[model samples]
Target: MSYRSMTLLRFCSPIVIQARHGHRMRGKAPDIAKSLKERLAPVILDEEVAKRNDIGFPYQKPPRSAEFNKRFDHLKKQRSDSSLEKAARTTKLQINLDDVKVDWFKTAGPFHIRKIAEHYGVYDDLFGKYAYFVPRVFLDIKFPLNEDTVYPVYNGNKVHPLQAKSVPEVSFEHKFALSYSQKPEENTLWTLILTNPDGHLTKENSEYVHWMVSNIPNNDISKGDQIVPYLQPIPPKGTGYHRYIFVLYKQDKKLDLSSMKVTDLKDLEKRTFSTFDFYKNHEDSITPSGLAFFQSKWDESVRDVFHKELNMKQPIFEYDFPKAYLNYQKQFPLKQPFNLYLDRYADPKDVNKRYLEERLAKTHPFEGPEKKLQFPNAHELKKNIPSWKKTEIRKERLGRGRINDAV
Candidate 1:
């Protein structure tokens, strides 16, 4: 018996045998051509291509394990408990404002303060009035796990770039150290206002109040009542950087803040807050005491904080890539070699020369006569023409199927 027949007989013990004179039976099988074609056929990946072209895959952070969740809850509870206990203790501590002075403003007044305001276009027509009172309040950000450090407040050396995402949940602490020449009086009442002059959508002398405490007794902010509860800085993206100004005013007496136009926190959004106007209106009642400010930008944490804490929707940023790019170009103007070939052959005159002349005319219209354009010498032109003509000839020859002979 054949090997195949023997194997089939072993596997199928109940098979019926048909006897024939020197004849073997064969089973039907698949077509070899058809099988090969199916195996070698090209795969169409249109669906995969479409999926790749569509929106990006959603990134869902993996859920924390039970133990991790428990630990996080415990830490959160501990923080809340400790914060309450600290607040209770802080309320009892006596804060002295008698030694505090607004002299820090004088040191920063000439160039530093103005430069910062000018950088963000925060100054107005009445900038000079409040300029002298710009304070030297030291600001610090305390992170959940890190020690407090001095925040960048108009001082370039110590100025730190605050990332928006990392700071929303973090609270900042500020204290005013008296300048040497000035002394605070015990009977003097003060007002503290923290605002973002560049927070408005439109360029106006407006500000969004982050924190406002009026009738502060002797610069003790913790003891004072909050007119506008502390709203952490939420500098929206694409608005560039924002300046969070902490302005302290020495009130002649306790301000009857009930008469102010914006008495409620809800009315503080995009409020017209001009330092000059405020000083002018209350010139008799309030004097500029101290001023401190820091810059901030949008971060990922802003979305959550805005919606949850501030009860506001996150603003959709308008991408200003072109404007930013133009500004960068202006700052570092490109110094590239002039395209002599294009200038000489493509146009009747040097295009770059014309463009420069036109720009100069617009910049200095009343200046002397237009400067002359000096063209390249004949020797320089002769040196470059041969290479250009050779390239053109080679290209022409290649098009005509005579590339082998052209070179």
Candidate 2:
């Protein structure tokens, strides 16, 4: 009844299965090819070329805060997504309160930049103004010591050495001279500003203008007009480390300061300065280009600079640490052992062990209690000696009985 029909069905089944398999393979071919290309792509370590998919590196990183577009702006198209846009695409931040990874913040730094000829500095190469990762140059803030120069570090290394960027200490007497990696363009001027955001209690907003120079032609700072003559950082003693940041800005044109308020150069109130307010007022023209900062703590020179140079009272900051705990609380690891580790998992509204203990003591009067042990007090022996001068009266009494070795 079915021999002839079964033979025809078997022939059609093989053809139908082959056609379905072919359709499925065709549908997945494009995705498979794409993944294959990505897997097989070569990494070029010698030179940096912008990639369309990655926006972390400078070539891909849509140019300065435009983070570094001062020159790299041309490298990335204006139509592409901005750095902030890319940052939002990150569901979770790669760096956190505990970690120190700035590369994951999607900013890439210049690498392998050589120092300006004859300049004996490694930091001059750290920010990479010559190699071009946005920061046009780094400052060579030379101190008395060779290693005190501020160096920038941003090569996407596994370990971000933030301390490398800071100068451990700087002197008050020497005004750190800055050298540039490259000169400004013709007719273009530069401005060098030194500010201390950690002025302790010195300023209204905690910012102190250490130095300011405007209209510097082609990076020769000596030729510029010194508006706020370099005030050697007079951070009040005990103020800790104050970061003196040197920010260089490129002037769109010559700046006219006639309208701006010029505080009397000698006035200590001139110390109360705001770099943001200054930048806000001149937002139209000046563009931040290079940055280098150093840290300085209170030294003896600060006292002399305050009293002798500024002709004012030397502010000494002595933090009076609150005196020792006279009445201490019985916290764990202090006076008691922690037995209830499960307390952490208990409900917040639930009664605590302390309250339960007090309740139990009230209900059953603690059964019975005794305070029977006491040592003879040194104070009782000497009619009230203070703790510091108190002698071990019991030990002295015990020693009197053992006179075998007495001289």
Candidate 3:
């Protein structure tokens, strides 16, 4: 549901308050004042509101098993147990998990492109709520191209390997078309939509050109040479993030992208330089410098068009979640504090311990007599765990006489 609709509905609901009991009264003396206070009572949705909205989520059904019914009855008894509630009320907020920090923003050139697009007059219309026409932020979304597949010939555990083969004959025509009588500044950021050979959509088939103001020369609203990649997405199997960068450079006089109030070309002269050249030229006549800027830099980075997308940063803050199994009694009211104990054994065995260790290293990474010593390697503990061969036999005292024992 849209946020606006939910907000409107909530506004019509009544506010609830708590009241206190009066002191010992004789003959039930009349009270004049009313109290308006919210207490530690569970906030339940009003039945009338629920009925009016036709909302019936998770309706309870009669228990089908006697064992489940007995457990449910036991829980009801626990709800009435005041001792449990008192203990819960004393709990405090405690998060035991190591905090992690990562760069959430990944796409590099989108930053510059967006700034320039804004200067050129159409970023607002084209990009809308998204951070520019292209969202550089990774949202854990995956594509089928990166999915691991096994071949029958090799081991079943390993994914089929792939390599790059230059196929000069395999070429595709890429074109950028823009039409705006409303002036360039009033138009939207250009969007490039890609389609497969059989007309199905592919990841590399999509791209956006946003104005990058920081790199622009004095916020000049100029339309530069259209960008067309000689090579594009090559189908492959892999398991990593990849990035494609596109940079634009305007070769002519500064162009005015602002909307024209008079609908005339008179203001065009004031925007551009007198000596700047303009005209359609052949591909050979034009020279480009930063064409090969998107080369991969890190182990996680790949030059291939088809690869996984990863956020450069990790989630900054986190809180230990409250127990879902515990139906809060009065003692453990809303916003009550609690501690988290690590029951690490319950975690999946395959979880990447190295990743968690790396995050912990950033926080409090060391343990030694010297405070400055670096944190001990997590994997080191596995090898250093006491071995039977390394243990030595020690002599015992007379009172605790060294008897012929298993040791």
Candidate 4:
């Protein structure tokens, strides 16, 4: 065969032709097959396919039939009802103590007097007086005087001797009274805390804890561990009489004494104690059971006793002696009743009403003119006056007009 004829034959052979166009033909065959398969396939609905496959489509949702709509509405109602029930469960109601007869309060006795007598009765009985003749003016309304409650006893005496010359030693036996209703259980515990609220004579606020004991079983304070040792009262020479307050708390359980910051005698002076904060922090654990107090002034006996027993130096009379005391006495006279002293001799409500009236009168005086002129409308004024002058005149007229119209 001729070379030209052989070359043409080789190029035109079926196998050679197939190799050159095989890839393109294969690619077109898939597309053609896919189109043909789609045309011949069954018309399966989305719902049918989802049901058959047990699958959910993200973009395609099933038709909402009556049953579905009813179910959805029921679900919404249930959720709303659940939310309302949750709100009802979480809501708290405020209780007014004055409006309610609290059995606990009655069993506790006159809250204030019971507390004071429990702590100070010993000193008062020993000193042959009721609460050191604490003037009614000095007594707070929260702690009204109640003569029925029992008091504490110190060194076999009912009264607290205050004569500086015969200031009692720090080593004195102490006892407390049990409430008639306080039938102690196996878990009952008590705590005794002694504090001087007026540690800083110049300032009206200060706290000096003289002693603290905790975990006394069944109101037996003597059985408790003394967290802070007892210290004799030593008022600064010039700093008016100091009220040494003793308070007792009924503990629901043994306290975590180690958590207390003021654990030693040295820590007492550095402590800034708050009875309210203490009770708040331990609300679930402790309740105030009793309280008592006695006033003490600087005397030579107190100085000598403090020096011998505490090895503490006498506080120097930095400020004038008796002057500050006299001023306080004058400010809170014994003759003045507690309510009058607290009110400063005027009704606070009346004062507040007068102040509000004066302010309102000044803010909206009644003497202004009853009739006020109205300015021309902006559209009407624009026909006669320049725009700038119109604005200025409008502002001026508005300012001059009575504001009572708005009121």
Q: lDDT (CA) for every model shown? A: 0.51, 0.50, 0.28, 0.49
- Backbone Cα, N, C clashes tallied per candidate: 4, 4, 25, 12
Candidate 1 Cα outliers beyond 4 Å, as residue runs: 1-122, 125-184, 202-204, 259-272, 320-407
- List the candidates' TM-scores in order: 0.42, 0.41, 0.17, 0.35
lDDT of 1 by residue, 107-214 (tens): 334345546644544444334422332333333333222456323343222222233223322112223224333453446567777677667655565667666778
**Tens digit per residue, CA lDDT, model 2, 1-407:** 49889888878755344443433455456735667667689866533333212111122334235446543664555337476457767754243632232333223322322122113222222222222223444444432324444433222112111322222221111111123323423455777777667674644544676677788776566777877766676667766665666666777789976443345755767556766567658868876655555555766667767777678898878677645534333344443323332333344235354444543453545554233225533325465765322333344334431121222
Candidate 4 off by > 4 Å: 1-187, 201-204, 259-268, 305-312, 318-407
lDDT of 3 by residue, 237-316 (tens): 22222222332222223333333112222221222111012111211232111111111112212222223321123112
Best by lDDT: 1
- Which residue runs does candidate 2 get wrong by more than 4 Å? 1-134, 143-184, 200-203, 259-265, 320-324, 328-407
- lDDT (Cα, tens digit) per residue for candidate 4, span 1-407: 69999899889947544444444455555635668668799986676433422111112222458548977997899677766666667884344664353333333323444445436443333222222221111111111124443333321122322332221122111222233234424446777776666555343444566667888775455677776665556677767666766656666678876655454443324445555456557768865544446676666666665577546666776553332212333554776655435534455556456545543554545574333345434335646776655654565346632122222
Worst 10 residues of 2 by lDDT: 169-178
lDDT of 1 at 349: 35
Rank by TM-score, descending? 1, 2, 4, 3
Worst 10 residues of 1 by lDDT: 52-61
